[model samples]
Target: MTDAARDLISKAMVDAGDPVEFAAYAPSNIALSKYWGKRDRSRNLPLNSSLSISLAEWGSHTEVAPSESGIDQVSLNGEVLDMGTAFASKALKFADLFRAGRAQPLKITTRNTIPTAAGLASSASGFAALTRALCGSFSLSLSEAEMSLIARLGSGSATRSIWHGFVRWDKGRAEDGSDSFATPLDVTWPDFRIAIIPVDVGPKSHSSRDGMNHTVDTSPLFAAWPDQAEADCDFIEAMVREQNFTALGQRAEANALAMHATMQAARPAITYLTQDSWAILERLWAARKNGLEAYATMDAGANVKLIFEAQSQDDVTTLFPEAQVIVPFAG
Candidate 1:
């Protein structure tokens, strides 16, 4: 946490108007299928549908207690925040949105437990956790739907962190954005422990927020996104119900490719893949080509996370022996 974040959190603690302190951990999510598009920007509503798997080993921890003053602050990594950039992050945006003008400054403190930016959804978890914590501090009786809505304002995919395991963000029928909450399906934490070692956690080659925004405004392919997304969502739901790994992986691969497809169709295109990225991809392909059951998926970042049974950890590691592997476990 930075000094600014600390200051923000400190003020939140003492604020006469906002006295409650709230804390929560936001877990990292990997899209078996991704969410793209926007119904509303400030509300963080989606235009297209997407689904993801929440990882137990990675995410963020957040605490938002009462503020003493009329001020809010943020602190990260033991550094007092001198930069205002963190405020510009989606976390603050969602915090303010949920406050709904009764907003008091929260001294928000946060720490990342997962590999951020290395194709991990740490930001999604971070913002979602912040929104949940701030909302808690407000004495707000937030329903999961409302909380998901609040989290959405922080990041489109974040809505999933509110749940524990396999989550599906329903692109429901409300234009007011009330029906956008994610629904958790069956998930057993011990069954899904796949080690997700990160390759890089700095600036991603392409930002998800930016990519989704571009897909909405500039991509010709955006026309058909909603239909495809809805279908993928349904497919994933059934797969989870049946615990069908093949169906789940198939949907995941299609969803990931579709999310990437829009990036290529954007006005000025971009891809997060580096030589490191492709090398990992090629390795996964070679493994699969040789009749191995191994597979991998990516978001708008370069880290290539392998999807394998917890029991296959040793085998998966040996196959892509050089790359980091996250043994998947149920949430």
Candidate 2:
């Protein structure tokens, strides 16, 4: 087994007894410096560090227990889901971690409030919640750092969702990926809110994982993403510490665009920005020009998340009538 697997097994100290069940809730996080590529595919380690804000209103609640049968049973939002697809892959990873060296199947039931394919951070929350639930059910007393490490194995972005408010996932250098985990930053600005605009509620044409893989393997622009993202993370972290809204918003927007540009330059040209998305982005630029403090960032989906103040909610709602305002989650 790999060192990563060994470390995980070392943490699984649950005694063999009656199956234990427990539930946990974890909120999704929007990346300020987008994590778009991987350094270690097997371990799901990122090429560069990223900073994110956990959403208060968007999250997932998961319940996990040992299954009597040998097969794993997974359910999401009251619907029984197949375990082979991309969606259930996180759950599968969770079960594998929960079982460790033991041959045990898991029954996982998860419910997510985050809208599917809305460009929100549902996978982050989903995996984090599942990991938390599994840890609780198995009575594994893992530190926050260890939990973040396990969460990263499920989904790269999920590492940051393990914490509340502003969090940063360091791009560690270990081949075993013992250090590639997220740390919660101090919440310097509590009023820093985001407006989640759902341009298209339908599923994304290309998954973030698939897009990142394509870009890393084929995109010429991918070469520079790591350095740029790292610098952006450093700058953004300082901006947060100083509570500089203007600099933070600007850096967030630039970092997101840089990540998307690499994806767009991939061999197959993985493009997630729609015409409506561009219109919304332009509106944010206009709002910023007009002193509205509105700055936008996007993930692998077409939806745009705008960073603004709670006092500017009226203007934000008026500009994007369908946008939903999300406050920073306190984990």
Candidate 3:
């Protein structure tokens, strides 16, 4: 363990019970202005300000407890993971954050309502719930911003998932990353709804982190992304505050396309879109051209999420009956 982990572990406290447990639930978020690159990988700090909305119906419930053995254990959806794996390492690191001593091993259990590692922000919800549970166990009285800071250490997008409604993650200037955290916009639009269309159910061929790093290192189009993202967020925040769904959807779609364009220009040319994804995009365009309001945004996976007014929801569902899942915006 690193010295930092050791310091945190040294401060852990426990009761007389043989096992002490903490559990929490956090929802996944869909980024309107995507965070495609990291300025500081060690801190999981983003290269630009990104905005997202937390999905109320999709989330993860995570629990952490003292283990009987001396080694850390992680179980996700009842499947035990090898400790030498990266996922398990991350879970163990989170468990270590709540340790009062080096000998205190932990067993972590996480259950996700949504699919994991398919570019739907599963890591975001998982890490956020894990961070919340571990902090609660330690009785740490951290604010939402402080909790976000801890969550970002595991996944950058997870910082935004810590809040409800619209969230904006600031790409802070501090080297230690104290200023880089998420803040809720404190506004909700009841008329706004999101319908998720899953085009690819399998895990992404390239991890989002690796794809982002590749784009940052090799894509020439990356130079303009941060400024574009900032402008998009400014407009998105304004439109969201005014409840202007038309303008909000338009900017969100444009931002997602621009982010993907950068990835396409990377040396390895990472493209997450499938033929079905393009077909769905064509249908979204047709819906708009036909005078029905709809806009689409895609992450690092083939799934397409459509944003439209509540009244047009049935139309969207009819347009994509093959949708793997349809969920409304819950903030």
Candidate 4:
């Protein structure tokens, strides 16, 4: 860990009598403005601010407790994971931030409600929940903002996953990333909906982290992205607050396309959107021309997610029968 990271962790350290079971749940989120590049990889600081809407009831549940077997253990969705597995290794490494060379053995269990590594924000939810569980297990009294700062060490998008509904992560101007954290927006639109059109539900061809680094290093077009993305984030946040669905939908779709365009400009080009993904966008565009009110965004994977109001639910479902609709603010 970097000195900045270690210092932050040290400050948040608390003493608990004994490790007891602590569990937390965090909702998966879809970025509206998109977090495409990083300013600081060690701390997972973003190059530009981004906004997202949480997926209600579709996320991860994580539990942390002292290991009964006297050794570290990890499980995902009830399946015991080998210590060398990627997820297990990453989870344990994250735990090390709190362990700080201590010999405390922890049992970390995470169960994701959404498809893992399939374009949905599973890592975001996973890390957010783990951060919460770890804090609870250690009896730490940190605020959500503090937790968000810590969770960014796990995943950049995880900073936003600390809350439900609309959230924005500010790409703070601190060298140590101490000011970088996410906060929930004060607006709530109960009719807001998101629909997932899964193109490939398996693990992505490339991780978002690797893809981001490669694009930043090789994509000449990325020079223009940071500034444009910052402007888009501000605009999208305003639209969300004003409940302007039309403006929000348009800018969100444009921003997603712009992000992908930068990736296409990379040396050797990294294309996550498959032919089928384009087909969905083509169909969506055609429907939009005929007055269907919805916009699409994609991440580092092939699946497409559409943002629309409750009024367009029937039309969206009629157009894409396979789409899985989720009401973000539903009780």
Q: Give the alpha carbon lDDT tens digit for every residue of 168-214 in model 3.
A: 98888776777888999978677777778877778787889999999
Clash count for candidate 4 is 0
Candidate 2 per-residue lDDT, tens place, 1-331, comes to 3656347646466453434888999889999888888988878988899999888768999998777676788888998888786667767765765566576677888899886645575789998898788778878768877888988878899899888889999999888988899999976566778888888877788888888898999999899889999999999999988888889988999998988899888898988999999999888888778878878899898889999877787989998898888878432
Model 1 TM-score, all chains together: 0.85
Listed per candidate, the RMSD to the true structure in angstroms reads 5.8, 2.2, 3.2, 1.5
157-237 per-residue lDDT for model 1 (tens digits): 888887667788887666656576687776554555344435566776656778778777888987887788788888877
Residue 30 lDDT (model 4) = 94
Instruction: For candidate 2, report its TM-score.
Output: 0.93
Each candidate's lDDT (Cα)? 0.67, 0.83, 0.80, 0.91
C-alpha RMSD (angstroms) for model 4:
1.5
Pairs that collide in candidate 4 are none
Backbone collision tally, model 3: 1
lDDT of 2 at 105: 74
Error of 1 at 62 (Å): 0.8
Q: 3 or 4, which is superior by lDDT?
A: 4
The reply for model 4, stretches above 4 Å from the true place, is 1-5, 115-121
Off by over 4 Å in 2: 14-18, 68-71, 83-90, 101-103, 116-121, 329-331
> How much is the lDDT of residue 290 in candidate 1?
75
* Candidate order, TM-score descending: 4, 2, 3, 1
- The model with the greatest TM-score is 4
Model 3 misplaced regions, further than 4 Å: 1-19, 98-101, 115-119, 324-331
Task: Find the 10 residues in a row with the least total lDDT in model 1.
Answer: 1-10
